[model samples]
Structure formats: structure tokens, C-alpha cells
Target: MTAEPPLLALPLHAAAPTGAPAARSFTTQLPGDPRALYLSRVWVRRIVTVLCWRGDVLRAVEAVTRLVDNGVRHGIPSSVPPPEQQLTLSIATDDTGSLIIDVADLNPAFPDFEAAVSGERGCGLWQVASLGARVTRFLPHEGRGKTVRAVLAPGPVGL
Candidate 1:
């Protein structure tokens, strides 16, 4: 494994072109330690709650928990220094108003998406997909790491 470029913090607000939906996003980096699993869960729940998404908050939290757990377990290479092992968590709303949860880690390899979706692999991703989340992986522009993304319908609106 190679050294990962530091993740940048995106500004909270950005300009969107005409006819384009404005993006609402939040991002944070956490140590790639096991405790990140629990912290990710809490962070997602709080973000969803703040977004006023009451209907699917639990599902979102569960999905994030699994994804972050995967990152901490498989994405961290022991060859890297402890301080360098970090993961980024991002929550955002796409143009369609769906919730997007992304967990990025230093590993470029991805889980077998097809097998995980088919329940042939581990249950973590299977359960996430079963919750109506569209799970996918992509290499960030920097090419240092890959991000596992889960997109889900935001569910009913909250007051």
C-alpha cells in the first residue's frame, strides 16, 4: 500500500449551475481505528436527525455502521503509520434529494460488489443493500484511496 494523500474538507456551501440542484454536504475524517465504527454510527444518526430525516434515520445509521466497520477492518493496511490510517465520512444530498453516505479509506481494492449484493460474500454489505441502499465503490480523483458509497431514498420528510 502507498501513502494516501490527505483528504480535504469541502466548503459547506457551493454554487450550482442553472437548473442544477444545490448540493448540501458534510464531511469529516476519523482515525482508522476500530472505534470509528461506533463514531460513524453516531455521526450519521446525528446528521440525519439534523437534516430532519426521521423516517429512515435508523436504516441510514445501520448502513453507515456497516460501511465504516468495513473500512476500519479491511481498508487499513498495517504497513502505514497509525496516525496515517484515517478514513473520511461524508453525508450529502444528491440532485434527486436522495441521501448519500460515503466512507473513504486508504485501500484502493474494493469488495466484490456483485457477490456482496447476491449474499455470497459477507453479510455487512448484504444487509446494507437489503435496506434499499444502492452500494457502490469509486476511486477518488486523488487516486490514493477508494470510497464506498451508499445512496438511499431519504424517506418521508420530517417537521
Candidate 2:
């Protein structure tokens, strides 16, 4: 099969209005690559920017980059077909403007935060967990993929 095509982040301002609830969900398809990691971070920043929560933009970017980077590195096997190797990312905010980010890929090998957090400071998962986010859970979809989700609450709250 062929290498997967790239997925650029959608326009930042395309999100709901600035003062509106940042609750709308956005999804994008991604290929497995280094650029995917960088672009994913940019995407998170842009989304948070639209929500008028510029403070959490950097933290959100770092957290999302770590999560999506894990997906690219561990969630998709190189042997899988290009089409089958795709990753899907979903982002939204709750009524209170809590930002939620989810990244899914074909591998069922979900990132075990518990395993990664065995008191290790360097673990990416741990870094994500420490980002002042209220992590809901990691959910494995019925058959094809698993999703990792983290939530960062609105303004002056999320560091």
C-alpha cells in the first residue's frame, strides 16, 4: 500500500463564535508521521484560541501533542495498510468551556497511564496527566481503534 496522505488542521476561526460555548466538536483525519505531531499541536492551539482561552493555549498544545504523538508512535503499526493506518482526532468543549481532545488510531494498545505513571517523571503520558487537565478516561472503541481523551477547563483555571 501507499504512505498515507497528510492532514492539515482546519482554519482556527472556523470554530464557533468567540463568546459562544466552545462545545462544538471538530474531527480531522491524520496520517502517521512526525509532522502529524506538530500539526496536531497547532490544531489544539488554534481551537483554544478561538474559544477566547488564550491562557490554556500553550498547555493544551503540549498536552495534545503528547497524546497525538503517542498515537502516531504506538497506536499504528507500520505493517498496516495505508488506509487502515489512519488516525482520527476529535476536539470539543463542554458547556463550561472545558476543552476535550481525543485521538484515535487502529491499534488497540492504548496508552496505559497507570503503567506509564509508575512514578516516572519522563513519561509522556505522565506529562499529559500533569497538565492540570481533568482526564476522563481512555476508551477503546468496539473493534478498530482506541481513543485517549483529556479535558482542560476554561480560563484562569487550566494552567
User: TM-scores of all models?
Assistant: 0.81, 0.73
lDDT of 1 by residue, 33-137 (tens): 877876777677767766565347888888888888888988888887997999888877656667777888899876586797667988888888888887877
Tell me, by TM-score, which candidate is best: 1
Clashing pairs in 1: none
Q: Write the per-residue lDDT of candidate 2 for residues 1-159, one digit (tens) a residue.
A: 243333344421222233345456667777776667766766666666655653468788888888788788888877798766767777777577677777777776644556664435347777777777655444453456567776666565433
C-alpha RMSD by candidate, in order: 6.6, 6.3
Q: Tell me the lDDT of candidate 2.
A: 0.65
User: Which runs of model 1 end up more than 4 angstroms from their true locations?
Assistant: 1-22, 156-159
Highest lDDT scorer: 1
